[model samples]
Target chain A: MTTQQLYEQIQQKQSFLCIGLDTDMNRIPEHLLQTEDPIFEFNKAIIDATHDLAVSYKPNTAFYEAHGLKGWHSLEKTINYLNQKHPEVFTIADAKRGDIGNTSAMYAKAFLQDMSFDSVTVAPYMGKDSVSPFLAVKNKFTILLALTSNEGAFDFQTQQVGNEELYKKVIKTSQTWESSENLMYVVGATKAEFFKEIREITPHSFLLVPGVGAQGGSLQDVCKYGMNDKVGLLVNSSRGIIYASQGEDFAPAARAAAQKLQQQMAKLLHV
Target chain B: MTTQQLYEQIQQKQSFLCIGLDTDMNRIPEHLLQTEDPIFEFNKAIIDATHDLAVSYKPNTAFYEAHGLKGWHSLEKTINYLNQKHPEVFTIADAKRGDIGNTSAMYAKAFLQDMSFDSVTVAPYMGKDSVSPFLAVKNKFTILLALTSNEGAFDFQTQQVGNEELYKKVIKTSQTWESSENLMYVVGATKAEFFKEIREITPHSFLLVPGVGAQGGSLQDVCKYGMNDKVGLLVNSSRGIIYASQGEDFAPAARAAAQKLQQQMAKLLHV
Candidate 1:
């Protein structure tokens, strides 16, 4: 999906909410286990109920990968289902993958092309060659990890590279790469104040902001600093939205959690 | 497998050569595509031929993942086959996976615990929490990416963070994490001079050195600085060994290539 198309979806839905499909097998409702693919079933239900409220769905590959072959199969089904059912909704494969040049191309093919995700999250540790492959894939977005929400973000990301922090350096250096126009960034919403500096680096590129729900970042703070004129902020809420309830009404509950965030976003967007 | 067991195997085999199973379908022989599972079939042939020469097999996950479900299944079969048939040979799932704490735990479980790799490569961009979970896995090595072989390594890795380079800070900070004893690292053999500084920081920790054959790094230079008393280096050569012959003689040809590297390692060890 193009950035303009994504923005149109946000306007149409009056929301920039990206519901995270971090479907944990143990955390899902127990009755779903009786189904053929519990993970897929849960994901499908959540996507079905909440697709209208959210502009995008970010599925973390690690959650599915935890189950091995069956898990990978579930991931396959989830992506296929999304493409088939809700092609308009932006799909982000939150697979933090990066490697050497050739290997990185394989990963780009795996997630962006084969899996048919609109975008895939990439680690920037390996630098230009490792990440450029993903950018090379036309019409697909490479959401490079900049300032992660995790406590571990402080380890090296916040450290000084020269005069600036490493994440700032990452954002600045990434723009100089080939086809960097396809580049978006993963900036933690928890670091709302830093969003101002980040936006200054790349004013127009969309930022996939995580840490809005369970991880605890104020929506207003993120929007106040991070939101572009096009509302280029996909504030993701995973655990807080998906695991809202473990009862039979889990899907509706998921929708309710998502609705709450979407309502707040709608208000912010003045829609 | 324990670090001592890995060292013992290296001593017994007189080699620390890690054969990288970066099995690209396009690069593999045409005849193998006729087989039901060409990736697995090719991997089986290569493993059966050169298992004795190479102390470890580092299967880059990108190759399998590119094929989607079938690719994942091939990966599953390949790892299972290695565990069942060649248990003594140290296995490295060159997945380069690291996420937030919980997600990283899932990845650690996926590769180290469930997939049953002796070790799994992890990216350190996310920092301490993202990596410590991999270390928490008992008897499994978490090979952290310290300095990579690719040209992009100069982008952020070689950049000065404080008094030392970012890779050095990574190596230093990593040693302070919990279960740091199980932590090994990836230092590219391409930069052999950097190996001395890496070894200074991680004296006993095994370094999974890539960029040896296809990418061109001298074995002699790597050992001169990187090797410890236990011969702590798993020098990986992927394309040079695996793609030696794309004909029916591929297996034997792979064996020859591995034998050449093993012989060099043996000479280095004075075996």
Candidate 2:
């Protein structure tokens, strides 16, 4: 999906919420285990319940990959379901993947071409060639990791790089690469204060914020500092919404959590 | 495999060679594509031919992932084949993966527990929580990206971070994580001079060195600065060795390429 299209979706829904499908089989309702694919079934219901409230859905590949082939199949099914049912909603394959030039091209093909995700999160440690292949794919977004929500984000991301922070250099230098206009970034909601510094560098680019709800990032702080004219922010909530209630009413419960966030986002947007 | 077991294999074979199984189906011999599983077949032939010469085999996951589900199946078969036939040979899943705490644990389980790789390369962009779970696994290694070989490495890695370079900070910071002993690092061969600084911080840890032949880094230069008493380097050669020929002679050609590197490594080891 194009940036304009994503922005439009936010306007239409009054929410820039990106619900994370970090589904764990063990954490889901006990009844769902009887199904053919429990993970897919759970995701299907959640997507059905909260599709309108959330503008995007990000399925972190690690959750699926942990289950091996069966998990991968669930991921394939989940993305396929989303594309068929709600083409208007953006999809993100939050697989933090990046490699050498040729290898990265294969990754770009795997997530962006074969499975058809609108964006795939990429790590910038390998620099240009590793990330360029993903950016090279037309109409697809390469959401590069900047300041992640995890405790590990401080290890290197916030360190001084010449005059600016390392992540600032990441945002600045990546802009010069080919087709960088298609680029977006993953900036953790936990570091809401950093959003001011981040916006000074790339004011127009969209930021995928992942720390809200469970990770203790306030939605209001993120919007207060990170928002742009286009409402350029995708606030993601995973465990907080999806696992709100593990009973058979899991889907409706998820909708409730998402609706609360959507209401908050609407107020922030004055929609 | 433990670091000691890897050092022993290098000593027993008189080579610290890591042949990358970057097998591309389109690039393999035409005759092989007629088989039930061309990728697995190609990898089997290459591994069988060069098992004695090379101490480790690094199958870059990106190559297999690009092929989709069938590609993932091929990867499963390839790793299973390595574990069964050549149990002595160390395996590295060159999948540069990292994420949040729980998500990273799932990734650790995928590569280390389910797939049974001795090591998996991880990007350090996410920091301690992203890396700690990988280290938590018993006898497994987490090879963190330090100084990559690509031109993009200079983009963020070489930049100053307070008193040290970003890559240097990466090395130092990761050392304080949970199982620092289980940690190895990816210090690309192209930046051989950086090894002097890297070794100062990580004197005993194994370093997986890529970019020897195909990417144009001198084996001699890498060995001169990077080697410890254990010959702490797994110098990988992918295209220069794996895709040595496009005909039925591919297996033998791969063996010959691996053998040539083994000879140079043997000389370096004074064996």
Candidate 3:
């Protein structure tokens, strides 16, 4: 999906919400376990119910990977289902993958080309070579980790890199790389205040915000500081939205949680 | 495998050579494509040939992941083959994966528990929460990227965080995390001089040094500065060993390449 297409989806849906499919088999409804692929079943239902309310779906690959081959199979099925059912909705393989240049290209192929995700999250620690591979693929996106929401964010991301913070340097330096026009960033919504500084470096680039509902980040504060004319923010809510209920009505319950967020975003977008 | 066991392997083999199973389908011999699982077949041949010479096998996951589900299956088969055939040889999933606390735990499960890898490489960009979970796994290793072999390493890693470089701070701060005993550092052989400073921070921890032959780093230089009393270095040579020849004698050619490295390591070990 192109940036303009994603922007238009946000406008049309009145929500830049990216629902995270961090589906854990143990956490899903007990009844779903009887199915052939419980993870995919749960994701299909959730996507069915909430696809219209959200502009995108970001499946955190770690959850599926935990189950091994069966989990990977579920991931393949989930992605296939999404592409077939809702081509309009953007897909983000929230797999935090980065390596050497050649290896990074393989990851780019795995998520972006083979599985057909619109974007895949990448760590910027390896710098341009690691990130540039993802950006090299046409129409695909590379979401670079900036100020992540976790406590570990303070370890190195926020440290002074020269005169500026390390992540700001990441943002500024990454913009000069080949095909950096396709670059986006993963800025934790928990650090809503930091978004102002982030925007100073990447005023136009889209930011995938991941700490909204469960991680105790304010939507208002994130919007106030992070929003651009293009609504350059994808506020992701995973556990808060997907695991809204553990019963048979899990899908509908998820829809309610997503709908609430969508309503809030509608007000923010004045749609 | 525990650090003690790893040390014993190094002593017994008189080589810390890590054969990188970066098995690309296109790069392998054309005849291998006739096999049911070409990637696994190639890896099995390489492993069978070089198992004695190398102390460890680091399968760069991106190579397998490029082929999608079939590629992932090859990874599973390759790891399983290693665990079954060469139980003593250390297995490192060179996946370079890291995420949030919960997600990191899932990745830990995927690589360590599910696949039974002795270790998995992780990028340190996300900090403590991302890395700590990997450390939580018993008898498993978290090889953190301190200074990579790529040109992009200078992008953020060499930049000063305070008085020290960012990679130095990564080495220093990571040592303070919980279960830091299980940690190892990935200080590239390409930056052999930097290993002196890295050792000053992590004196005893094993360092997985890539970029030995194919990427142009001298083993003698790395061993001179990086080796501890335990010979604390797993020098990886991927293309130089694995793709030594693309013809029918590829496996034997790979064995010869690994043997050459092993002999050098043996001389270094005074074995």
Candidate 4:
């Protein structure tokens, strides 16, 4: 939703942990597969298990999409469940959708209106028109890709053309767009060292920090440089949480993982 | 499909036209809307009407995604129809998907493997890990967003830091990545002047060119500077082709629009 709303949740819960629901079909417990909609069942259990501990549930759309129509249905059901069960928990459709102006508007409508996700991750490569449509929707924030966590991120994202890195330029230029107030950015937790510089460019914008946990990013290091006065960080851990176990204890183990992160987030926010 | 296969088809048809199936619910004929799945019905009609005129059919995923589960089903049906009825026609899932390595791999599977689309549109902002995953798939190409046609495309794409534009740098650097041979690029037709420069960077790769009609891009200019020895252009016309008529004659009108582009393409090819 809005940064103000997210800030309140972080303050109230004393947590900024956004549990990632990157659910893999083969990785999910075998028992759940017997259900009519296994992915939805798994997501529901994870949401139910870890909702209170997590300020947000970031469902990377790619995971659900791998299963085809069933995957999309699971995504819809998960979002609907979140709205019905845990209204306070911010929902981020980690879709990374960006296109032409008219298309982006329809995309904004699909995730924000039709599916009812609080936010959708967007790519800034197509520039202002691709990203602006998402921001135009009231209460829906556009989490633009700034600095990602993948190793290949260094390939183009960190390339120096003249003086500044490309990612920095993207952030600075994006700030000039209409409804820039609603824009957040995706700054990977693995690139925690860049947080200080990233903050300089986007001081107030909430950072959707992915690539922690299974991706070997240190939470302590991320919090050290990424945290703002408003607890402006949504450190996401996907596989490390959801795939904690291969048995029926999977959901509970997921809850434990999320709880551990939430406890750490609480301590981080204490300062 | 590979560039060679795509090239052979273009040669066979003597056309560079790639009819875009941007089928919208509101725009579909009223009679088709009465069907259980209007999107599939509309796509089937258009495909039936214009299969011979076009070498490729690029379905902008947003149109299907807007309708939710039914939309996705329609997409699957349309792709299946293309495979069964017109196997020679190249199929593209115009789903601009890019993410981290693992996530991107799944997205590749979703479109290229599971869904059986030949190629997908991807954003290059996330760099190599994001794109390489899509390229890794056999018989599938990753069409990276290079220079787009939209108004906001200039916002970051054309922004100069020191010497080269960001998009130019992206094109220059991405050539070194793994399986780059499978990479195509999106160069909007509206940016016709930049075609020569783009050709210098990516000479052999196929270009999925959008903005041919409704976006006010000139087909003549696109062919002049953008065409290569390989006839390497998949010039897309979405609204101009699909929404040619809102009435029951929509399918036949779509064929007519496709024929007009095919005629121009044939003349450009000197066929």
> Using DockQ as the measure, which candidate wins?
1
Q: Name the top lDDT candidate.
A: 1
Candidate 3 RMSD to the real structure: 1.0
Clash counts per candidate, in order, are 0, 2, 0, 0
- Residue B127 accuracy (lDDT) in model 2: 89
Worst 10 residues of 4 chain B by lDDT: B154-163
Model 1: per-residue Cα lDDT over B41-107, one tens digit each: 9999999999889889989999999998899999999999999999999999999999999999999
Instruction: Give lDDT tens digits, candidate 2, residues B1-271.
Output: 7778888989999999999999887798999989999999999999999999999999999888887778888989999999999999999999999999899999999999999999999999988888899999999999999999888888888888998888898999889888899999998899888888888999999999999997899999998888999999999998998899988899999999999999999999973
Q: What TM-score does model 4 achieve against the real structure?
A: 0.97
| Candidate 2 wrong stretches, greater than 4 Å | none
Considering only chain A, what is the TM-score of each predicted structure? 0.99, 0.99, 0.99, 0.97
The lDDT-based order of candidates, best leading, equals: 1, 2, 3, 4
Report the C-alpha lDDT of model 4 over A1-271, residue by residue, as the tens digit.
5678889988888888888888888887999988999888999998888877888998999998898898899899999999999999889999999998888888898998999899999998888878888989988888899889898788777877457888888899889888998888998888888999988888888899988887778888888998888778898888888888889999899989888888888887875
- Interface C-alpha root-mean-square deviation, candidates in order: 0.6, 0.9, 0.8, 1.5
Alpha carbon deviation, residue A253, candidate 4 (Å): 1.5
Model 3, A83-122: lDDT tens per residue? 9999998899999898889889899989999899999999
* Residue-level error in angstroms, candidate 3, position A2: 1.7
DockQ of each: 0.92, 0.86, 0.90, 0.74
- Per-residue CA lDDT of model 4 for B141-194, tens digit only, reads 888898898987787788774578878877887888878888888998988999
User: Cα deviation in Å at residue A5, candidate 4?
Assistant: 3.0
Per-candidate Cα lDDT values, in order, are: 0.93, 0.92, 0.92, 0.87
